[model samples]
Target: MSLWVDKYRPRSLDQLSFHPSITQNLKALASTGDFPHLLVYGPTGSGKKTRIYATLHELFGPSVEKLKIDVKTFTTSSNRKLEFNVLSSPYHLEITPSDMGNNDRVVIQDLLKDVASTEQVDFTNGAGNGSGGHGGPTRHRFKVVIINEADSLSRDAQAALRRTMEKYSSNIRLIMISNTTSNIIPPIKSRTLLVRIPAPSSAEVASVLAHISKKESVKFTDSNTEPFFEAVANNCECNLRKSLLCFETIAMQTAQINVSNDSTSIIKLDWEVIIENLAKSIAGNRTVANLAKARVVFYELLSHCIPPRVILKKLLFCLISEVKPSMATELVSIAATFDERLSLGQKSIFHLEGFTAKVMVALEK
Candidate 1:
């Protein structure tokens, strides 16, 4: 159950909540037989990749079929004899997303360069020459390549990619995922279908959480589930991952215990503690002392993969709840500004510091 990342991913498009319009848009493209390259932009863990891959699977079935039928149809090859090509020949191409600097367009282009150079053969159906032989008519397929964090793509790298996208638009459908459409280059942006994925609505997010709780055999009351879900959603800024993690944390710490007292803190982390801790981290306090404390708290909050934007806003909500009404509006404004930078992939420690200072100063007065 600890491996909930894989365990709980929405297996079907219907399993994804509150983004029906976006899913419908993708569904339309998938069914159309003319899937222009797509940029599925949204905050992290908001189901961009899941939704696209779900559409791919719904259209093509499995990974094998996706690589073969869709990609193997690109037969514009110049081989003399024949080449046998496996769907994932050399079979190791994968896109791993992380905050590391290794994520750039050069690496993406290099990977494409390797894929484009490979040959496909149909020796089984026709007479073929030796290993270096390029003989009969061969069939090749277009490939689907995804850049998980497209917002992280460097400016120069994106420029390089614009040329590659134009060059291979026929043979490849490039899928770029980001938190916002603005981060992408206008030309690259122009070429692809844009699926704007929104955060899950409160009702939609709760329905799924309720289903999960029931599956786990945890008996959360109907009344309590909504409040908890709503609270976490607001805290995690409507990020699906964080909302799920809130349930998981309580479930784990309590031995997956079914508790009617969902009001009690399983991790002993009340909203007040959360506010103060967020303030500390936001106040330029990423020190060993702060981080050591933060890791346990952060992980507890993050296991569900909630978007960072959600968490920051929730922290603001907590601050607002604790602060005077006269200053609540100002703090809320600060939270929004902070989240905007975060979604753009700007490190928020500095912005957070300013936000926390304002909150703390406001609190002090």
Candidate 2:
């Protein structure tokens, strides 16, 4: 069986549950035949990808949903082979920084240039087949290039992307997805229409949980399901994807959700628990031995593919509670410095370790 997150995901703009205004705007843009490049950014699990796909579906009909994964290889200046997966359909393609590595500028430019040189022609309909008298083909004039984790893109790659956007404006539309625009350069930001999608409120998240529960036929023993779902929604911090997975975990264990008895423990993701333990270690004492131990844990988290910025952010949230408000303010500044360094430097461990040591020193002072 497919995961509930995927099974219940909204496929079209009309079916989207939250952000009615954004939905309406996307609909109007799709109706305009084509639009300028878009930078759709928001927090994690905020349905940014969902809205982008829905907009694509609206523009290209069902053909946009016929997705396929293709692995493309490029040769680097050092003659090394860099292979990356490209998810695409007839109308759009999706790529990420992980796919291009340090050679994103070259790979992205070549890929987009190839796509821009071709005109999209739909053969399924006579009107789109250029068969009609004097009107030419009625197919969509452009294809979309979706850049996921655009914030993680290096400065050189983003510069190359800016130039590509200007050169291929006629036949290619770029949609960049990022958690934040703090790292995005100004030139690209100016070229695209910025769409910021905020995270759903707790009440909105609870309603979605309730909808999923009813559809799944899961009955709560509690007289009112509000507290049960509200608890889940709050526990997941209003992250819809995380909320669904949390609810499904509970449903699998027992259909009867009891809010009063404290029997249902919200399952914390393993990485979260690890970070919590790391915070406790820091809180226990600020010392060389502890810092050494913390380094090992940091390496473990990074090895598991957790982004350093995310680790640092969560680590700050955990550490803030253990210190005074004034110290917490100081800690935020330290984290902010390391965060910028994490984005600019190649070695994440250096920045992460540096942040930890600085926190230890600050706590001591």
Q: Each candidate's TM vs. the true structure?
A: 0.62, 0.94
Name the regions of candidate 1 deviating beyond 4 angstroms: 14-17, 64-103, 117-140, 221-225, 255-262, 265-365
**What lDDT does candidate 1 reach at residue 23?**
65
Candidate 2: pairs in clash: none
Model 1 worst lDDT run, 10 consecutive residues: 68-77
Task: Please state every model's RMSD to the true fold in angstroms.
Answer: 10.1, 3.0
- Candidate 2 ranges with C-alpha deviation above 4 Å: 123-139, 262-265
lDDT of 1 by residue, 1-365 (tens): 35454577765565666667776776666554436677888775577767876766544344322343122121112422221222342211235223423344445555565564454333433223212122233212345666666776667667877887777766666777888876677988888878777777766766777778777777543445666655555655566776677667766665544334545322333644775666556444435565456545555555555445556776776666555689778887777776656644554454555555555555455
Give each model's whole-structure lDDT.
0.58, 0.85
| Top candidate, metric lDDT | 2
lDDT of 2 by residue, 203-222 (tens): 99999988998899887776
lDDT for model 2, please: 0.85
The CA lDDT at 67 in model 1 is 44
